[model samples]
Target chain A: DTAVSQTPKYLVTQMGNDKSIKCEQNLGHDTMYWYKQDSKKFLKIMFSYNNKELIINETVPNRFSPKSPDKAHLNLHINSLELGDSAVYFCASSHSTANTGELFFGEGSRLTVL
Target chain B: AQSVTQPDIHITVSEGASLELRCNYSYGATPYLFWYVQSPGQGLQLLLKYFSGDTLVQGIKGFEAEFKRSQSSFNLRKPSVHWSDAAEYFCAVGPFGSGSARQLTFGSGTQLTVLP
Candidate 1:
């Protein structure tokens, strides 16, 4: 069984379209996060949810919104997708009590905005 | 403002050769450091982490890293490299306190290639 999984491994859509990426973790973690990797492979945190509560909101655009239906699921929705939004999005989870930064990540979802 | 830097954008080494990847961080306190490996088209896997105690830490896949507080460096090392080890390696740093951001600041990854 996959510890962390994300749906829509690849997404290609026209500009101004709205799309959502779904994530789920079976690790029973309390903290979930979304990260974006740019063309240059520079990864940055976009959002973080702890037990369905928004904890870390990076300097991400307002068009992007993250929703956590429950502790095991966190979904990202992008409205009016722009060309700049075409990047690999990754979902990760970790236990807050773990002193390590060991995050379980899902195989990234590649988004291509036309 | 915490940040991580991987000076080398790419590294090439012959199979069976020794490898070392350098990582430096800037933080007010002793930040938690980590090394992650990402295969092509796959998510990142944690290689190792350094929090306290011994400066050197061993991890899966025969990877090891030494945390040097004075230099603010945590470098990854492998005695013998294999072709299968070719992948992208990233260095990340985060605050030490609980309930803190725990948001990691990742470095621009270093792509490693194993030469034949």
Candidate 2:
């Protein structure tokens, strides 16, 4: 289907361990982003890539790294996962030139750090 | 500071009743506003967005939102809500222009509970 798809919809791992979530979009958009929804359901942007170039990075820790292999894929790798790192991660994409500013999102990957 | 605020954490409405969810933002300049809905255990779906032009914007799934520059608010409304409308709603703000590289800042979210 033509949509933003992410792998490992649900992940449960022990603290201090590492894990990664991969996202792919077929929307042919130049901009992709990673957002984290906390337990309070507050969504916050972690990283943003436009045309495979990192353009925006919030105050996220260095342990969380985002790699965009191509314009269609953006992967997030978390090292030494902490219990507080557990949250639902979302992948979104949009046309940078679409002034209306609509974003298409993935189903989300729920991470539970035990 | 740039942030979005959703005053009501939870709102309950009877089926077939009208619904309104409040959203407020604090930004230095006029920002691009958007509303997104998330069903239970689902990803966010764009309801509508207002970048420029008309203050009132129509969205999918019978949703609509009005941008009030004076109040710094973008509130979502529905004439009649369906039972399936029970979900979490989020309000977000982006940079002022389409060429800006800033990411979105989302509100905490409001959970809508539709009673039968």
DockQ of each: 0.61, 0.59
lDDT of 1 by residue, B59-109 (tens): 999999999998999999999999999999999999765644356889999
* Candidate 1: Cα lDDT at A46: 92
CAPRI classification of candidate 2 = medium
DockQ-derived CAPRI band for the predicted complex in model 1: medium
* Number of backbone-clashing residue pairs for each candidate, in the order shown: 0, 0
lDDT of 1 by residue, A1-114 (tens): 999999999999999999999999999899999999999999988999999999999999999999999999999999999999999999999987776667889999999999
Interface RMSD (C-alpha) of each candidate? Answer: 2.0, 2.1
Please state the i-RMS of candidate 2: 2.1
> DockQ for model 1?
0.61
**Per-residue C-alpha lDDT of model 2 across residues A37-111, encoded as one tens digit per residue:** 999998888999999999889999999999999999999999999999999999999888866677889999999
Candidate 2 RMSD to the real structure:
1.5
